[model samples]
Target: MTWADSLRTAWAGMWSSKLRALLTMLGVIIGVAAVITLVAIGNGASQAVASRIETLGTNVLFVTPGPGTPFTTRQVAYIRDNTPVARVVVPLLNSGGQLSVGTSTLPAPVVGTTPGYQALGAIHLAAGRFLAPADITFNRDAVVLGANVSQALFGAGNPVGAHVSLLGQRFTVVGVLQPVGQGPGVSQDNSVFIPLPVAQFLLSTQNLSAVLVGASSPTAASQAQDLLTNLYTNRFGSASSVTVASEDQVLATLSATRATFTNLLAGTALISLVVGGIGIMNIMLVSVTERTREIGVRRAVGAVPEDVVLQFLLEAMVMSLTGGALGVGVGLVLVHLAPLILKTPAVFTPSAVVLAFVFSTLVGLVFGMYPAVKASHLHPIDALRHSG
Candidate 1:
């Protein structure tokens, strides 16, 4: 039989058993869809992290206390004065507890930071103003609320100039930060900001939890990181006293880790494809047995062994390809809509789509081979005598 004739016959056979064909294709559809959706989610998370890092400035480096004691306020001043590339150095004193506004309470990550912390972190006031140098110098009991914190505390009411109790002290809300979504560093939306000295006094410690440093440029940031590392090593008499990292370095590390995790997830999802292939193989084997007499008649008339094999192979591929097409549609929809459900972005790469389709096709070809060969190898007389 001609290839076209074999193709039509294969398609007709599949069409005749529409329900079975659909049932058999379900495996491939599910496998492909799962792989695409998982990969898209992984890619989206990576993108979110990268974008957050970028928004925070690659020229920024986070310096945290590593081993021994935390950095002292004087030590922070010394680093600012000595570090060549360091342009802005902000000391951070964290209050790790809940804040109360009337009867409402929420765990707002309270930070005591310098005036430069606002600009360095791209923080803008939605209402009122940030901590001025006077506030920091005088150690005033003024506080700024993050967007979410303000909403949770005051609902629709403006929080500026309102009082919120923190660590048994009443702090007047001087400002409310603009809504900045969760990002790489501390979440600005769920935090409370106060002057550095007030935070130290309230938290009752002069030791700094961390220091935010901004360099003149990306290159300068790297220089600043190295210089800070060396300076801390000398001052603390050990390399373990401080942890310094530029945003770029952190981004690279995070990207590599995400890539590894993505690969692992994709590999696990691919196992479903293998299972789908096995399903196809088993179903096709049964198909060959059921159609033995039909195959016998074809071969007895004029169909060559290759013709018989091709017919069965075509049927298998068409089913898988159809499944793959459907899977792609379902996956694309999930990628577009899942972000809303997951509250994270979902990025669909062309490479991912192509890979899924190609893998599904390969599955069909690989799994269909055995059944096609078996059907083709059967003698016409034997096949004719065989019952379904």
Candidate 2:
């Protein structure tokens, strides 16, 4: 028989037992859908992390002290003076606090940094200005509102000159920052920025949370990181006393970690496809038994064993491919809705979809082979004489 004729026969056979065919395809459907959805979520999370790191800029270095080894302004100044490649060295202090404007209240992260903090990148203003040198020097009670904080406190009104209470202390709003969205560490959109000294006074601590360093160039960033690492290590008497990482190093580490997790999830999901293939094999074996008499009649009518094998194989592939198509639809729908439900990014990857579909087709082909060969090997006379 021609390939078209074999395919027609396969379709007829599956159509005669529609419910059974659908039941046989169920595993492939679930497997493909699961693989696509899980991979998409994993890829999305990786992309989100990468983007956040990229926003920190390649020319920047993040220096975070170990627990109980917080750096003071004097130490920060020494690093600034010593590291010639570093263009900007800004000390940062972070704390969680309640912000209130009139009766409206919301919990937000408060950042304390120098005016040089603005030079690091991802700092943009939608309305007024960022922290000024005078503000830090004078320890002004001035604050800058992040996009979400401004919205929560002032609604549609201008927040530049408004007065707000932060941790029960009244402060004047100096600026409103444009929305920077979520990132690796603290979310810029949900934070409030104040003078470093003011934060030190409010938190009643001379310690800093972190230090941000901007190098003159990407090539210089590595040198700056090494310089800072040595400085901290010598001061604290251990290499682990502080963590100094360039943005590229951080991105590479995060990418490797994310890739490992994504691969693990994909591998786990692939087991479902294998299980589904086994189910197909089981059902096909049963089909071969039930269709023994038909196979005998066909062989008696000049149909070759190869034709029988081809027909059965085609039927298995058709079922799996149909299930894969349906799975693609379901997976795409889930990818679109997942971000809303999970509150994280989920990107649809075409490569993942294609891979899943191809794998499912392969499953059908491989699992259906033995059943087809078994069906074809039956002696014609014996098959014809055998009772159902």
Candidate 3:
């Protein structure tokens, strides 16, 4: 028989047993859908994590006093729009500072930070808060509590007038900062924010240890790096004093994390596909037995062995392929809709769609092959002798 004739006969057989075809296809569909949905969701989550990190601050960079470099609050100025790019520098002063309300004493991350830290840390005041121009102006002994700190030490107890001990000195709580999570999330609460100048004076270590610099946005973070590097090189005459890390670095780390999850998901989905393929093979084998007499008659009437085999093969392939297609649709829907159910946007990717379709076709071809080969090897005499 011509290939067209074989194709026609195969399709006719599949169409005749619509219910069986549908059942077989279901397995293929599920396998394909599983792969698509898992990968898409993984990628989406990766991107989401990156975005959240970037939202913490822009063009943010850190500096650590290098080996042999003593950290002191130096005369260097904080980098600002007005500070010549090559001339600006800030000393990093990380110290232990004490904050007390009434009799409650809480020691927190005392950063001897330049004024720019106010913007870079996204520090906001919950009450009479944030070091005002006057406070920073007068070099006042004042303090601000991170959101978590305010809740614990004050909790609407009015911390504005509260006295806090910094190191050994007494300072008044000037501002109660709205909670800003610790940088890159080291903690959620209880941080003491003092002006960089105040930190330097009290800590009695006047060499800039590290500078926290902010960029306008995540994408422009790299630009800020160049500015910082050039500034450091010009002032320190070396690159050892500063290092610039963009939000992209955190995103890359998160991507690596997602890869681990993807591997796990892929392994599970592969097992499902294998199980589904075995089921298809089993069903197709039974079909061949039931249609033995029919196969013999077709062969006797001029249908070649190849044609007989093609017919059975086509039925299995069609079922698996249909199932694969349906699975893809279901999976894509699930992945895309997940974020919505969780009150977030779904990340749709075209690559995922193509991959899903390709996987489905593979399932059909792989599971359909054995049945086709078996049907093709059948002898007309033996088939005719068999009772359906």
The global C-alpha lDDT for each of the candidates, from Candidate 1 onward, is: 0.82, 0.84, 0.65
Runs off by more than 4 Å, candidate 3 = 54-118, 121-248, 342-345
Model 2, 11-37: lDDT tens digits are 898889999988888888888888888
Q: Which is the winner by lDDT between candidate 1 and candidate 2?
A: 2
Candidate 1 per-residue C-alpha lDDT over 121-158 given as tens digits, one digit per residue, 9 for 90 to 100:
67888999999999987878999888988999898889
If scored against the real structure, what TM-score would every candidate get? 0.64, 0.68, 0.53
Query: How far in Å is the alpha carbon of 143 misplaced in model 2?
Result: 10
CA lDDT of 355 in candidate 1? 83
- Residue by residue across 209-306, what tens digits does model 3's lDDT show? 55555555554556667766686677788887554455555546556787887667755775677677777888888888888888888878988876
Segments of candidate 1 deviating more than 4 angstroms: 55-58, 63-86, 90-211, 216-243
Model 1 — TM-score against the truth?
A: 0.64
Predicted structure with the largest TM-score when compared to the true one = 2
Error of 3 at 2 (Å): 3.5
After superposition, candidate 2 runs with Cα above 4 Å error: 55-58, 64-116, 121-127, 131-211, 216-224, 230-242
- Least lDDT summed over 10 consecutive residues: which range in candidate 1? 47-56
